[model samples]
Target: MKKPKKPKRPMLAFAVTEIDDHTGGIVWARTKKAARIKGAARWGYDEPAYVTCRREPWADRFHSKPLPVWVMVANGWHFDCLGCGIRIDEDLPNWQDRCGADDTFRDMLREARRYRKWTPQCVIGHQHSDVFCSQDCKDADDAYRAACKRKEAHAISVFQAKVLKRFPGVTLVTDRDRMHPHAYATSRKRGIVVQQVSVEFEFPGMRYGPASLRWDSPFSSSYRKVEKPYFSCCNGDRAAFEAYAAATRRAAQEPTDRDHP
Candidate 1:
């Protein structure tokens, strides 16, 4: 009779419970007790060590596996296939082999292996490889930015409206291109078109003077006249506009008194 063949030794697996400097590792073992013994030898006294087994993948697609395996808990590594919810060895040979379904799977696996992070999601909750989930998300973000710009423009318009309401003779000077809001007032008696006192709404806090404001004008001579003096007010300060109107009226009256004298 042929000599009896010795039974093949079962494949052994060991999970890294702890390593030097709070790292993790894996080892093959002949038995569960032996695996634990090896882990203790490497990690020192009272460190965690375990005998783990590998499991087959549930499905063969990247999209099917939305969550990631290979997690770190208290400086210890844990391995589980998120798709199948099965315990796996640290090397993850079974899971990695199953991920070779398609190019997308390979790419996703590469990213997961490289960064050890899952796919990113947008603020609105769609997941993607990039910042946004799709073109629609990008468009929505763009629309949000545009709405903010329009709101700022509306604020400037509302401020201009308040100024015009307070000073009846003033009109927004559309003919002159400006970085900030600009308006002019025509003196009914003097027939002189002088720029009304307006604040620079662009930045650096609204202040008085034509130099404080910026504008584009083909006829630079038009704005050559000194800006009518008025009490400076903080931007969007309605009470300040009221005071400015009163001061301007007083200034106009004083000039007229001098002229008549």
Candidate 2:
């Protein structure tokens, strides 16, 4: 007998509700539960764990808030063709750090795996992963809290530079408010350490640009085959990006009746 289809629930993450494009169904992650687990995983214990989903290619707009939330689904270490399965930490007795924090990350992962249409990769917080800024910290002392905030921001900048080098032709944009006076003073007062040299201001053909250039055509256009959607514009090794551009140009040059007439 065919199993009955389960009713679609709104996918929610970072306290934001998810809306499915195909089914037009709305999904919001159980944020309170997920956040509780996530916080517990990261700050509340010796080691933290939680389950989350890889944000699909284009699921950012519907969020009432800004883009790039930290909540994600974590499938354990195993993979079953589609992608990696739930992390091995889920059921093991000493799974949290013993299994790399997969157990604590398991709550939402179980649900995502049942669907089998998506995958997971761990996303640390904004400072660690370049997502967002969060003031939520266990340290209640004002000075300590201020210092941590600066640390978080500094971590983000270091990671940002690393990402830029890893992805060529990638463009990144950050808000001005991110550099507000309070942010700078806090960093100075706290004595933030510079880990890596900042990304070069200019690299040949790799100037900062709009985010649109990151995604390639999912389908073949009249002109050429497009590339897949990439996380950042800086993707593609030297050879790959060049080859793609050459092919696109060649396709564009093809003689067309419309052009000649």
Candidate 3:
């Protein structure tokens, strides 16, 4: 015997009435029960969790009242296939219908034995992104980010060597300590620090760049930002600290008001 199909209900906006919070999330669903499920799922909780969902009409508008008002909320999550850019939401029939004639989604179900997502990653290192549709896309992105990071590390080392050699006493900054660039330098005036040095400054293979050097201010208890680097290296090479060194030299040579007196 052929099973009877469930009649489709009109999707409408159902407002969740809250007790304490004035603003709550507006959920769209066909029925009251569907609203509860969808809204709870959206908030990463069970249907009967903290939210006391009610069957409010679609015409209900959210207001800025003190308490017990219809509320709408959102987390700003994008549920789309990273590789193909298709809207991926298993709970929504409309979203599922778009995957017709494409078996990639089915493949996702078959292989993802533990967790199903347009969310999980292909590798441990890929945290900035997770909604890949295929292993190929994930691997490619992971490899690309790794390569770019390698380039950045290379650039950092190159900058460090240049500073240490070019300026006899100038040293490299370490992540852990606010160690001065040079041994005798006071805490108020550390020699030099490289910042925002990344491989993606070049993009493509994204091999790093636009590194800047800033010195600790002798006048104040803050690091002075270099407004204009004498030399900016997007690829993280040559003249990385030349402008900084020159500026330091110039500042040193200038006579103070005490000299005039």
lDDT tens digits, residues 1-261, model 2?
999999865545332122221111112344446444544444434222323323332433444443322232232222112112223222322223233444445754544454333212232232123321112211223455566566546644544544354443444545445431112222233254322111222233543432222212223222433332222234544444455445445333322222110
- The model with the greatest lDDT is 3
What lDDT score goes with residue 137 in model 1? Answer: 45
Report, for every candidate in turn, its global Cα lDDT versus the true structure: 0.39, 0.34, 0.40
What tens-digit string does per-residue lDDT give for candidate 1 at 170-235? 444343366455533322343333323343422222244221222222223564443333324445
Output the better candidate (1/2) by TM-score: 1
Q: Which stretches of candidate 1 lie over 4 Å from their true place?
A: 1-133, 171-178, 182-208, 211-244, 247-261
Candidate 2 minimal-lDDT segment of 10 residues: 17-26
Clashes of 1: 1
Cα lDDT over the full model 3 = 0.40
Question: Ten-residue segment with the worst summed lDDT in candidate 1?
Answer: 121-130
Candidate 2 deviates by what RMSD? 21.7
CA RMSD of each candidate after superposition: 23.2, 21.7, 19.4
Query: Residue pairs in steric clash, candidate 1?
Result: 177-216
What is the descending lDDT order? 3, 1, 2
How many Å off is the CA of 193 in candidate 1? 36
* Highest TM-score against the true fold, candidate: 3
